[model samples]
Target: MIYVNEAADPRLDDFRDLTTADRRPDRPGGRGLVIAEGTVVVRRLLASPYRPLAVLGVRRRVEELADDLAELTVPAYVTSSEVMAAVVGFHLNRGVLAVADRVPPPTVESVVADARVLAVLEGVGDHENLGSLFRNAAAFGVDGVLLGPGCADPLYRRSVRVSMGNVLRVPFTALPDWPRALLGLRRRGFTVAALTPRPDAVDLRRLPDGATGRVAVLLGSEGHGLSEQAIAAAELAVRIPMAPGVDSLNVATAAAVAFYELTALAHPGHPAIATPRPRQRTDGGTVGQ
Candidate 1:
């Protein structure tokens, strides 16, 4: 609960300018600290395993976190928003920031060890999309995320903000060996479904029963869709039905829909996504596998 009034205070260095925030990546340490902006995200950072080094904010913003900060071991640097912006090199409308070292990402095997429904992503380099995907996954009760390739760092400041800090709670991992890693998932009883817009793909509602054990939805970036190697590695190419000529949904939105369908089956009692209500397919038959 220490109130810091000076920007020159040595205790505030960890919360310094964003211009060089990423610069530390080239330093001997070779990595930048995790930064959480806004009160919501900052509160999440404080709760995460990553040890909070310091908190910087205007008085009011820091006060919002007083409940969490009561027994916090870190210092809270309070300042005017103008002074805060001058030190941080931009006018951060969030009015607060917290810095913490990153925790290690989980191993792919561990992330999927007990996963009933997981989301594996490829070429998802946009931070906001990545964050939104995590939030959607959490809302739909997805178990985890496995990064296939070209995925952005989920702990990046913008990702943390956009996720509303859900990134701090959802566990994720980097799956090595590219598409080859998908084999390892299958070995553990996961039926990997690559979501794509290709018409020849099986309609989501008509997916096979093999998806029961441990299901994983393989996702791709919105721009180009899944890579050939990804599609080739999957057990099924699944497509969500949309009106003709409607193209597809946002990557995160698509994840939400697929997660809702898959996870509802995996965990029957989960309430947010109720049991699927039978609906007609475009061909005029009862839906759901």
Candidate 2:
């Protein structure tokens, strides 16, 4: 650990002016780095496959990561909160931050191999939605995410923050050949189901029952939803039933519901699906026979 009194220390350059376009890895003139905010996300960054370059935080926040930093040889720069704010161009309420170099993403085939359930996305350019989808994917034991065209970079800072670091854990890769790649998934024995609000879509609850195969739930952007071509590529169209006058749910919110249903459909015995426990009465006996 090194204590730095000045915000201009060359060692802190990676985190400088984070809100600026030039500092955003997904934008022009930006360095391609995976940045993690807060101790929770920073801990996940350290645990991820990406290589940590350095860490910058206030004294307390830096020390809180002592165990995670123990085996690392990278510099952990400790400074006052004021210096941290000045260096980063804004006050980061999360206290600590870590920056890492992104490793190459896994291939689509590698991610798809041995997977029973996947989240396939198209035109999901919104980072938070993408992140939330990843979080839901992680929560339900999704094997991987297949990114179609118009998808945002999952490693972007905002997505990383919104996912609460789950983006680091979920494996994802770009899918080439546009909607045609989806056909490839089907050829690999996947039942590609496109999610849409179209009235003709099959109710999610009515999906054909069988836990004996792979399934990919394809989602689209929040605004336009799925394209006709993408929908055409899918083997089936599915929808979450809604009340009168309701057209659809938010992409990420819809993803959670779809992921839950699909995970149960594809992997009935997967550990994330917990067995229901008996409820007990206040008097200590079971509530029902």
Candidate 1 worst ten-residue window by lDDT? 22-31
Estimate the TM-score for candidate 1: 0.90
Q: Highest lDDT: which candidate?
A: 2
- The residue pairs that clash in candidate 2, if any, are none
**Candidate 2 lDDT by residue in tens digits, 168-272:** 999999999999999999999999999999989989978875423699999999899999999999999999999989767889999999988888778866665
Give one digit per residue, the lDDT tens place, for model 1 in 41-146: 8898899888898888999999999999888888888889988987888898999899988777777767887788999999999989999999998888888988
How do all models score by TM-score?
0.90, 0.91
Clashing pairs in 1: none
The candidate that achieves the highest TM-score relative to the unseen native structure: 2
Per-candidate count of clashing residue pairs (backbone under 3 Å): 0, 0
